[model samples]
Target: MSKSEDIVINWARRLQSLAQAGLTYSKEKFELERYQEIRDIAADMMAYKSDLPLAKVKDLFCNETGYQTPKIDTRAAVFQADKILLVQESDGRWALPGGWCEAELTVMENCIKEAKEEAGIDVTVEKVIALQDLQKHSSKIFPYGVLKVFFLCHKTGGHFQANSETIATDYFSLDNLPPLSVNKTCVEQIKLCFEAQADKNWQTRFE
Candidate 1:
């Protein structure tokens, strides 16, 4: 996106966050109405800029009622020798086996669950590889902020089976990576995981 578009999106996100907080904590009826208006305005701004309709944008961006916080996503980086496991998404591109963290599960548990669900692999957590701010690394724009957690996992068992989210699974080296699902997994993030895997003393990277 262009600089102007980025500015608008950033402002919309901030406005929606403020409005959400207001709606959650404010007791005055007039103040609640004002917050609701602010949220509608945020949705309008996004709708004007994007192809989505006003109602769609509102549902996607303004329906949450809480103090706004970044959504958490978990990624499992399972390696076999020099190759890393990657699942072919239904979109016909590859990504690390992972998804949105469940509210009831710990991050590590989410990692294990995602691996089993997406790639049909059983894995045990080895160490955290990185914690990434999605906005910093991804080009795709989200209605809310996102925090992506990467875990270096050791495969215990299970083999790939066709699933709803993924069509196939395979291992690839850095020298030969397939077209990646950039929104979910990027080259730099994969490189960080490889670096963590090679060094036993690797510290968990953040930001």
Candidate 2:
């Protein structure tokens, strides 16, 4: 995105945050109206800069309550031999099996659940291998802040099977990967997971 577009997105995010806070804490009706106006303006900014419909953008901004924070995305980096597990997503590109963390879901539980749901595999989360801020690593501007959590998982059981969001599952060597969902799990990050798996010295990387 251009610097001007960045400015618009940043301004819109800030305005949305401020508006949310103002709406949450302020008791006065006039104050509430002003906050609502701020939210509408923020949504307008998003709509003007992006292809999203204004009404959808408005709903995204206005539907939630309280402080907005980075949404967590849990991922499992499961290895079979020297290959990594990658699931064919609904969008056609492949990615590590995982999604938005549900209420009270532990990292291991979420990882295991996602593995079963998307890849039809049972996994035991070995450890958290990486924690990343998606905006820092990705070129696309995500509508909400995202905190990506990747786990090095141990495969236990189950076979490749299709699910609602995933069409297929397979393991691929690091040297030869399938078309990847770069927005979710990229080649560089996948390489890091491989390295971490091979060496006990590999430390958890964070951003």
Candidate 3:
């Protein structure tokens, strides 16, 4: 996406966040109506900019009523020797084993759960590799902001099983990776994981 497109998405997300907060706190009828209008405008902007249906954009971006915050995603970087673990998604592209962090689970727990569910592996969370702003790494425009936490995990046990999210799982060398699901995981992130793994005193990287 172009810089101009990125700016439009940023503006829409900001308007949506403001409107969501207003809807959550303001009780006055006229003020509520105004907030709804702001939300509609935001939804429209998102729909047009993203080439999504207006109703779908509203459902994804405007349905939630709260003080909007960046969503947390947990990814596990599990390596064996020189190879890093990656799961082939249903779409046939690979990504690290992870997904949206559940509100009920701690970040580590969410990372563990995603590793088990997506790649069918048991892992011990070693340390955080990075805490990244998704927009900085991906060109994909989302309705809201996302903070992706990559945990360097060590595989303990377990074998791959049939799962809905991913079709297969395997370890791939850093220099020989398959096509990636960029929205979920990117080449730069994989490289950082390898760098962190090699350095015993690696500092946690953050955006």
Candidate 4:
């Protein structure tokens, strides 16, 4: 992320925290409105600095009331032969084809949907590969807390179809994987996923 993006994110988080604190501690409606106005200012700052539009910034920040929650991201580790499926994103980096979990779908279903949407392949989730808590790791990419759930999947059907989110899809050996999108998929997490695939006794490792 750029320096401007960092500033925008930090401002938004601070504003959100302020709003939550005000709502929880103060009973007056006027005070709540004041804090909400501050959040709106923070949203404006984000709109000025980030790629997101003003409406999107407002929806992401000011519209929320109390406590802010981290999003749940779902991914699948689909192995074919001895290689694993990876996607080349629009930014020209390879990453596991996955995204934020949708509200209406179960986690397993979301992982399947992401595989199709991002990699153009249908897959069945066999078992959870790993449940990683991003907050525990001191990483610059996921500074804002996130929970990543990786599932060990088997290819069911469908041809590889790359979409707008992904430019190409290919398989890679564990040691020869391309530069990955660290914010979305990290090397340690991928190793854990592959390890789970190799171990039958390791049911699921949640961290």
Candidate 5:
């Protein structure tokens, strides 16, 4: 990552850590409110420093009452017989099976759950394919902040089942994946997943 990207990520991470700590230790509602105020202040400071608009900064800081940690986005690339599983997104575009990671679950567990929830398929997570920092990529969909983790998964059970988040699921050869939801997943990244699976090496990439 470049120096600017590193700086932004570090500041964002620190803000999240502070929010998590506050949520964990504060006993009184007033104290928790104070911590949230602090978190907002920190996020505002980052926005000012990074030149992000004020509204965007506020959105980044907003979270559930007791859940203040930075959110993780998890995705799984399920490959079978030289074809990769892809889901048709709500926006009428095709992408991988994944979504925002819940705080209650591990990264791998979240990956599996997303596959089932979005594509209606059971999958066994094999290894991490790559990790990408969204801020560095200038994404409008995630204008606030996000960190995405992509995992290489293998089909374990069940057939394709589309959920509310997706319209349909299908497998495509590497040469034929439709236009992806870049904010969620990218074709080049999917290619990396394929390479990692073929090499049997759990490689990780960062932006």
Candidate 6:
């Protein structure tokens, strides 16, 4: 992001934090009104930059009630025939079969569950390929930060199955890949997984 855009996002995050703290603790009408105004301004800033409507942004922001936290995303790069498994998403773009991690599961379990749920296949997670902060490494931007963990998984069993979240599952060669769901999975990250899978001496990558 440019310096100006970074400034805007920083201000938005700061204002959101203050508003949350104020709304959580203050009961006085005057204080609540002022905090609400801060939040409204923050929403406007975000909406203006994103080209989204103000109320839409406000609704997206107002639903939270505590300190903002990074969302956790997990993905698996399951290799077969020197190709990687991916599922077609609802939007018609393909991504590694993964999504938000469930709080009830360990990160490893989450990776396995995502593979099963989104790809309809069983996988044994072999090793961590990378743990990255999405905003830092990815060109794609979002309203909130995300911590993405990419795992190298071995297909243990089960055929390609399509669930509500995905339509079809297929393996693609790196040289001949389809359009990616950039927010969840990207070509660069998938390449890293391939590197780790091909070379046992590869080290874990992080940012």
lDDT of each: 0.93, 0.88, 0.93, 0.78, 0.75, 0.84
Q: After superposition, how far is residue 87 of candidate 4 from its true place, in Å?
A: 0.9
Q: Against the true structure, whose TM-score is highest?
A: 3
**Which 10 consecutive residues of model 2 have the lowest summed lDDT?**
55-64
Q: Over the stretch 175-201, how does candidate 4's per-residue lDDT look in tens digits? A: 998998887887887788778878888
lDDT of 1 by residue, 1-207 (tens): 789998998999999999999999999999999999999999988888777788888788987888999999999999999999999987899999999999999999999999999999899999999999998997776777899999999999998899899999999999999999999999999999999999999999986
Runs in model 2 with CA error above 4 Å? Answer: none
Q: Model 3 scores what on Cα lDDT?
A: 0.93
Q: Which has the better TM-score: candidate 2, or candidate 6?
A: 2
The sequence of per-residue lDDT tens digits that candidate 6 reaches over residues 39-74 is 888887888777567787777666687666777999
Clashes of 3: 0
Stretches of candidate 3 above 4 Å error? Answer: none
Model 6 scores a C-alpha lDDT of 0.84
Give the C-alpha lDDT of model 1.
Answer: 0.93
Pairs in steric clash, model 4: none
- For candidate 4, the lDDT comes to 0.78
lDDT of 5 by residue, 1-207 (tens): 457755764676576567757877889999888877777776666665665686776665554455443468898988888888889987888888898888799999999998889888888987877777765554342324577898889887887655678988888988888878877777677787778778865557766
1-207 per-residue lDDT for model 3 (tens digits): 888988899899999999999999999999999999999999999998997899888888887867898889999999998999999988899999999999899999999999999999899999999999988887777887889999999989999997899999999999899999989999999999999999999999996
Tens digit of per-residue lDDT, candidate 2, span 1-207: 899999899999999999999999999999999999998899889888877888888776567889888788999999889999999987889999999888788767888898889988888877789999998888877567889899999988988777689998889999899999999899988998998899877688997
Candidates sorted on TM-score, descending: 3, 1, 2, 6, 4, 5
Which residue pairs overlap in candidate 2's backbone?
none
